[model samples]
Target: MGKPTGFMEYDRKDNKAVEPLERIKNFNEFHTPMSDKDRATQAARCMNCGVPFCQSGMMINGMASGCPLNNLVPEWNDLLFHGNLEKALQMLRQTNNFPEFTSRVCPALCEAACTCGLNGEPVSCKANENAIIEYGYANGLMKAKPPKVRTGKKVAIVGSGPSGLAAADQLNKRGHDVTVYERNDHIGGLLMYGIPNMKLEKWVIDRKQKVMEEEGIHFIVNTNVGKDVKAETLLKEYDSVILCCGASHPRDIKAPGREAQGIYFAVDFLTRSTKHVLTGKKEGWVDTKGKNVVVIGGGDTGNDCVGTAVRQGAKSVVQIEMMPKLPDQRAANNPWPEWPRVCKTDYGQEEAIAVYGKDPRIYQATVKEFIADKNGVLKKVKLVKLEPKKDPKTGRMNMTEIQGSEFELPADYVLIAAGFLGTEDYIAKAFKVKLNARTNVETKPGKYQTSVDKIFTAGDMHRGQSLVVWGINEGRHVAREVDEKLMGYTNLP
Candidate 1:
């Protein structure tokens, strides 16, 4: 409660985004952070409610209500409001390992559950976080501090994504020699390639990697654990092994003409786009210039594809979504302190509308078939409308195709972003760990240890495909559990 009437006096303000048409020229982060004074005003708007659902991190109606990391939202906001930026940075980093990554990528569940948003707009917690972190970097407040003593216990983390990085950071802080193995040519598995440069520039990840390395965290990239390097060797060498390899398997769209050329998975497309952006190489690039693109599965990855295609000078873009459109406002069944179920026009769709004069999303529709030419090159897409229907036995709503509502659109390229199934089987097989019904690594209820001794898991590999925040959460928890099992007690927060 920096100011009693702060919420009333100051309205919520967010970072300004670059206009769509102009920003489509390059794959750079577009939003410009506000001044320090404006950020303080935004931080002042935090009422710091008695309960503060903004940090509850609870699940209601199967959706996250607040930040899964349980970030100290109110304390940091108050500190920022009072211009205590050094203290604010400390408070922000207490729970989050990488604010720079989450500030730009996270959907801001904290703001959605903010008390101020009950009747009006929510506080700009995400923007404030970005400001605090960027300030730390600019002012040289963020630096590497390696542990003074080593515990003589070496731990191996099998991924370089958020979860693996967070776990490595924590264990390294506790005097354990931590080694992270990334399969890709660079560290930051999903952060490096899976995400586009427009949202999170690669330099941010590189900067964090530099700091983590200075903190005595060894990184081994361009060497896969299950393939190039044997899992048995790591298990034999390291005292404990933590598998943070993400759910690398992408869900596929099985339709007629599925084997046609120009049809690619969303992850592969995005990875290629990012690699080309970073290296200026064309070996694996999927050029979309002058092409008509169709993206299946209207999710974040799909939106990234839309934006990427637009930047590559695509003549047209269409996003096919199987589910119906959400309402503009929250429905009556939905209430405050819960994740809102409302339609959101993301950056990519906004760009599509700005360029094409219409929203690119086709709600309640799916790909019936991929219509290709004789040479197996994708030329058009057959789309069919869908309607919600309830199953008689299961009593669950399902999207069924609508009769006689098929349509066709010119599509030279098709990107499937239908989400992921689970962790890849090779790594699981390498470790000989059991998988659950959902294909995620199985463990005891509410635990991170796997069936094999001295073996544990976290992040998308342990839980399933999820946000970076959830991955970091699982990483911190698994580190604590692993620390306890090794040292007979734990001091990690």
Candidate 2:
């Protein structure tokens, strides 16, 4: 440890956020980076535990406790504390392929599992990581280093999300020719469309894309794999095909007035908003200005919708959650080093509160029906309160709706932020890969190979809908497996 008493001496100080009202005015990243000296002090708070749970990346109670990529938290913290910026950057890059994206959007699982968080605040691992990576970018430490020799074997990655990108990066480093196919007009799949510009700016993705291009990786956008480009062609042309298409089939709320005109899937809404932001075109945008909006499903996507609506000058916003509000503090069943189950006010909710008079989230409630006008345009919504009840057979708690507890809200625009189902069927069927019960491409337990020979799968397609960090983890493992299969032996880490 650089300073043994640093944890005791320094209190955790996070990067300052722009005021909610001010930040909602524009869709830009709002957090101000701390100075180098201040960030080093925060880094010094790392206790360098004997067993660093921050990097364990294990499953406890069915939730990920640490970073899925197994980022070296303590080593980099100590290096950062000692002012070794280049060394810290190298250490950060050893495991994680993209710290810039994760630092901004990741929920900071490493911090949740930190040893210092047992009694007090956790070390600012995420911020320190951001500092290290940004330092590398600013000082020209991050540059393309293409392999000197070529393996001549070509690999095809079928998606451009985090997992697909990471797999492409690793395979290209091993001298294998890599080509990535993206259905969207841009390279990043979810990163380009699913996420809002406030959390992760498009420029960050473009920056990385530039570096990957310089490293000899080929990218083909505006091409859907199953429909536009046949899977048979890829199988014949490339030595190995890796499917990284994400779990994109959205879960829908089945209710009356479902055919309303103003109703939209959360992914489609976010995608349109991002498209408008990037292209500066508003021809098909879902404009919510001066309209009352209601977002369904209390998740990250819902929060993004709330934030987006606020920025677009929505007259009002309401976020509906089926589950009851969690305790303000961790419950007794929850302990240190485990993912805390507590109430968290995200940026979107904060913006909503600032614009509206009160918090927008209505916990323990669900939409019963979508009330529409005569012309089939969404006008209002009927919501019903929920109560937790145990199932008689399984003894599992279920949110049962309470009769006679229905209410109505003025909702001109209804955004369904409910989560996604498994991978879209067209891509899976086109590849002819077997799907497990969850609808994700079935591989041998803990393996990346698909049912078809010379075909591999990773990320949401292999697993399920998950965090960006886990996607990267899946990508790295799949690359290693594909490399071994191609060369009969592998040196990839």
Candidate 3:
């Protein structure tokens, strides 16, 4: 440990975000980073526990409890505290391929499982991570390092999201030729489009893409594997194929007036908003100006929809959650070390409250139908309250909509952010890969290989919708497997 008593001496300090009202004025990242000295002090708070559960990457009580990348948390914290920022950055990159993406968007499972958090505030691991990576970038320590020798093994990665990028990075570092195929017009599948510019600016993705390009990884955008390029062609050309196409089939609400003009899927809405920002054109954009926006499903994506709508000058915003509100603090069953099942007010919700004079979330509620005008544009939403009850036979908790509790709210626009189902069917069908009942690609338990020979899968396509950090972990893990398969032995860490 850099300082045995550092945890006792330093209180946790995180980056300060610009006030919501001001930040909402524009779609830009608003977290003002702490200075190098202050960030080092925050890193010093790492107690360097004997067990260090912060990097355990274990699933406890159905939720991840630590850094999924198994990042060397204590080692990097010690390095950072001692002002060895370049070393700290190296230690971080040892496990995580993209700290820049995760530092900005990840929920920080490490902090939840931190030893310090058992009794007090956790070490500012996420902030420290962001600081270390940002310092590397600012100091020119993070530069393209293309492999000197080629293994002559060609690998095709079918998505350009975090998972694909990580896989490409690792495989390329191992002297394999990697090509990433993105169906969208732009790369960074979710990062480039699904996320708003406020949370993760497009330039950050572009910057990383530039570095990856310089590192000799090939990228082919606007190419759908199943359609534009034949799957058989890739299978024939590449030594191995890894599918990182994320779980993109959005789950939809089966409510009336679903075809209303102003109603959109959350992904579509966010994608359009980001495309408009990047292209500076309003081709097929859903304008939310001076309108009442009701975002269905109170998840992070729903919250993003709220934020995006507000920035688009929506008159009012409401986020509906079918489940009951979680307790403000961790519940009795959710003890320390398990992922905290408590309420969290995200930046978008904070902005909604500041602008609308009240919190935007409506818990234990769902939309009944969409009320549309004669023009078939969404005008309002009929809502109903829900109660959770154990099914008599299955013993599963199911949301039961209460009768005689229907209500209406003005909603000129309705964005369904109900999360994803699985990877689209065409990609799996093209490769003749099996899928589980959930529509996710079927791989052997604890394996990334598919039913087809020389074909692999990772990230949401393999495991279903999850965090960006988990995607990186899957990508790195799959790279090892592919390397072993190719070389008959592997050296990838």
List lDDT for all candidates, in order. Answer: 0.93, 0.95, 0.93
User: What clash pairs does model 1 have?
Assistant: none
**What is the per-residue lDDT of model 1 for residues 329-430, given as tens digits with 9 covering 90 to 100?**
989999988899899899999999999999999999988999989898999999999999999999999999989999999999999999999989999999
- Those runs of model 3 whose alpha carbons end farther than 4 Å from true positions after fitting are none
Q: Which residue pairs in model 2 clash with each other?
A: none
Ranking by TM-score: 2, 1, 3
Write model 2 residue lDDT over 1-493, tens digit each, in one string. Answer: 8989999999999999999999998999999999999999999999999999999999999999989999999999999999999999999999999999999899999999999998989999999999999999999998999889999999999999999999999999999999999999998888889999999999999999999999999999999999999999999999999999999999999998899989999999999999999889997899999999999989999999999999999999999999999998889999978899989999999999999979999999988899988899889999999999999999999999998999999999999989988989999899999999999999999999999999999999888999999999999999999999999988987
Candidate 1 least-lDDT 10 residues = 4-13
Which ranges of candidate 2 are over 4 A from the true structure? none
Query: lDDT tens digits, residues 404-463, model 3?
Result: 999999988889999999989899899999999999999889999999999999999999
The TM-score of predicted model 3 comes to: 0.99
